[model samples]
Target: MLYKVLEVPGIEYIVLDFKSSDGNFIAQDLDDSETWNAKAFYQWLIDEVLVFTDDGISGMDKDLYKQFKAFANQRGVCVCDSRKI
Candidate 1:
């Protein structure tokens, strides 16, 4: 059997290690929960994910930076500045 994968055009796949204070290496996400609306960010992801469903955002593994890259690529489809930010 052959397995096929899809990705957004011109979307560069990125893989890199990032760190968070208080030692998230054991558990927890890289996002800064302090002084940031985790709920809003989560909701933003949900909202954007729905819009980018036709692109290449669905079924992508939500592990570490992989999901964000896909999300970024999907977001890249609609918004330019947010991808940079």
Candidate 2:
């Protein structure tokens, strides 16, 4: 998928731009949570974006959502968050 990474004041986000069938391009934000791994980010795309909500801002299956934390943990998703950078 084609996307862009943006850094705002206190947050970094991934922008997923989808062109609608009618030719309108809509951008969706997926909070990066500071993860920089391609594999982990791919999983985030599956677990957080695709599984939860296409727009990245809606409900997810409870069981699936609950498992994401553990999944993310195993992938070291939050490793960079507490770093001094």
The model with the greatest TM-score is 2
Those runs of model 2 whose alpha carbons end farther than 4 Å from true positions after fitting are: 1-39, 42-57, 79-85
Backbone clashes in each candidate structure, one number apiece?
0, 0
RMSD (Cα, Å) for all candidates, in order, is 12.0, 12.2
Residue-level lDDT tens digits of model 2 in 40-66:
464445444442334322344444444
- Model 1: per-residue Cα lDDT over 1-85, one tens digit each: 0011123222223222225463222212235322323233334444533223444344543352355544445434322223334
Off by over 4 Å in 1: 1-36, 50-59, 62-85
Clashing pairs in 1: none
Best by lDDT: 2
Reference-based lDDT, residue 52, model 2: 32
Error of 2 at 75 (Å): 0.8
